[model samples]
Target: MTDHPRSGAHDRLVTSLGTSIVTGELPPDSDVDPVALESQFGVSRTAVREALRVLSAKGLVGARPRRGTFVAPREQWALLDPDVLRWRFADRVDGVFLDELGEVRLTVEPTAARLAASRRTDRDLADLEDALAAMRSAGEKDADEQVTADLAFHDALLRAAHNELLLQMSVVIEVGLRLRDQFVHGALTTESADKHAEVLLAVRKQRPKAAETAMRALIEKSIADVEIAKKAI
Candidate 1:
């Protein structure tokens, strides 16, 4: 039931302009002249205005009296917004961005795992098991499958926590997983599965501290691997 952007002049303008802004082709504070955009995209002024409104809602652009539209500063951007995150991943994953994602994971995920240890339901466990099984079957050879499974595992973990705020973090977590998979070649390891297994065991045992520790260890290792990959790049 999601309203995907239609493949028309307005949607095309939105996507092209949003990507350009996010990727710094249109730097922050730069004026977004509506006439220029309309001419460039071969769209009407209304279409350009509509696209600008969408970007503004996502905190990617702002309008000033007599100044027209301008790209917003990085801090003003809605980084957690799903559309913005998708646009970001459309380009090469930046190391600084990855590090910021790692910091978020470290802050939120271990605590979520701890809560899951205390409150997980049978269905949650089933989902986690299914995700783990997918990971095992996919192994390192299937990057796409592995990333999907990896995302599912964390998604299940957050849902198991039963916190609405934590559940909301699933988008950011998925983006991080995709970025990791995209940048880190041959990154999946047996130890990764082992670490996830440890988390599952601790949660099943209702041991919050152990679950937190296991999740932290897994994320720490993932961040380390990403760091190594960044160096190689």
Candidate 2:
């Protein structure tokens, strides 16, 4: 119970302030006064400092030589950190980003699906099925959870292709998922889910063109959704 309170205090301070920091409430070059944060979060300086240390480890902040702590540049941010990803989603989610994601998906994911069709191992298929099942179950869940499952499926399929070059695109895919986390749930029709299932079927059947076609349908739908969202906004 004592540890739980301490843990909860630390997490609340970090989660609230981390979003503010990364979303530019505390912009780059902005000083982070530990006392101010402690006051604002109604916690001790020790707790606030510990929260800042977590951010510092992730390269979101840096301590200057006797000056103070300041926010780090976007390039220094921990892209893979779950907090950073959420902050990014909260910070800037524009149609241009989604459009770029759709373009990349059209160019990359379909072909990866085709290659997986030809090269996937039994283990790969088993992993793919697991991810698909997870995704299906997550469809009833939040967009964030669904995107995590959806990404696992595509990432596994890419790895299944056995192409080192394709594997490098994992970061790009992760970034795309982060960008699409909201737009996907908002725009995805039930038909979109079925379309993805068709792509999986094509991959399972070892039909390259079919795999490509089905994947293109999925990306094309995403592109349309991006365009529609742009017009609405």
lDDT of each: 0.89, 0.76
Give me the runs in candidate 1 sitting further than 4 Å from their true place: 1-7
lDDT of 1 by residue, 1-233 (tens): 33434548988898888889888899999988999988898987777877888888889999889887889998999989998888877868777888999999999999999999999999999999999989888888898888888889999999999999999999998987888887887667677888999999999999999999999999999999998887876
In model 2, which runs have C-alpha deviations exceeding 4 angstroms? 1-6, 91-93, 103-108, 123-186, 207-213
TM-score of each: 0.94, 0.71
- Worst lDDT run of 10 residues, candidate 1, spans 1-10
Report the lDDT tens digits of candidate 2 across residue range 1-233. 11323578899887887788777787887888888888877888789878888888778888888988888887898865766766656757856657766777788888888898898888888888887777777665466656777788778978888899888777777776667655544443356567767877888888988888888888787787667666765
- Cα shift from native, residue 91, model 2 (Å): 8.0
| lDDT for position 67 in model 2 | 82
Separately for all candidates shown, the number of backbone clashes (residues 3 or more apart, or on different chains) is 0, 0
